[model samples]
Target: MRITADRTRCVGSGLCAERLPDVFDQDDDALVLLCADEVPAGLRQDVEEAVQRCPTEALSLDADAPEH
Candidate 1:
C-alpha cells in the first residue's frame, strides 16, 4: 500500500502523527507531512487507522499504487 497526504485539506490535528509517528508528521505550519509514501507491510493496519482518524480526510491509503 501507499500513503498519501493532502496538506491543503489537512487540519493539523496531529492524530496521524500521534498515532503513527513513523509514517506521519506535522510541518512547521502544522499541516500533515508524510514521512514516506511507501507503506511497510507491518504498518499498513496502523496507517489505515491513522488515515481513518484524520478529521479532514486528508490522508489515504492506495493499494498497489504506482510510484509518482
Candidate 2:
C-alpha cells in the first residue's frame, strides 16, 4: 500500500505520527510526511491505524495498490 496525506486538509493533530512513526513523520509545519515508497508488510497495520486515526481524514492509502 502507498500512503498519502492531503497537506491542505491536515490539522496538525499528530495522530498519524503517534500511530505510525515508521510511515509518517511530522514536520515543523505540522504536516505529516509519508515515508514509504512501497508498503512494507510489517508496517501495514500501523499504516492503516494512522489513516483511521487521522481526525481530519487527511491520511489515505492508494486504493489501487500495486501487486506485492
Best by lDDT: 1
lDDT of 1 at 7: 91
Off by over 4 Å in 1: none
**What C-alpha lDDT, on a 0 to 100 scale, does residue 8 get in candidate 2?**
92
Per-residue CA lDDT of candidate 1, range 1-68, in tens?
78899899998899999888889989998998888888876987898888888998999888869766
Q: What's the lDDT for residue 38 in model 1?
A: 86
For model 2, state the Cα shift of residue 32 in Å: 1.0
* Clashing residue pairs, backbone N/CA/C < 3 A, model 1: none
- lDDT of candidate 1 vs native? 0.87
Q: What local lDDT does model 2 show for residue 58?
A: 93
- Quote the positional error of residue 11 for candidate 2 in Å: 0.7
lDDT of candidate 1 at residue 1, scale 0 to 100: 76
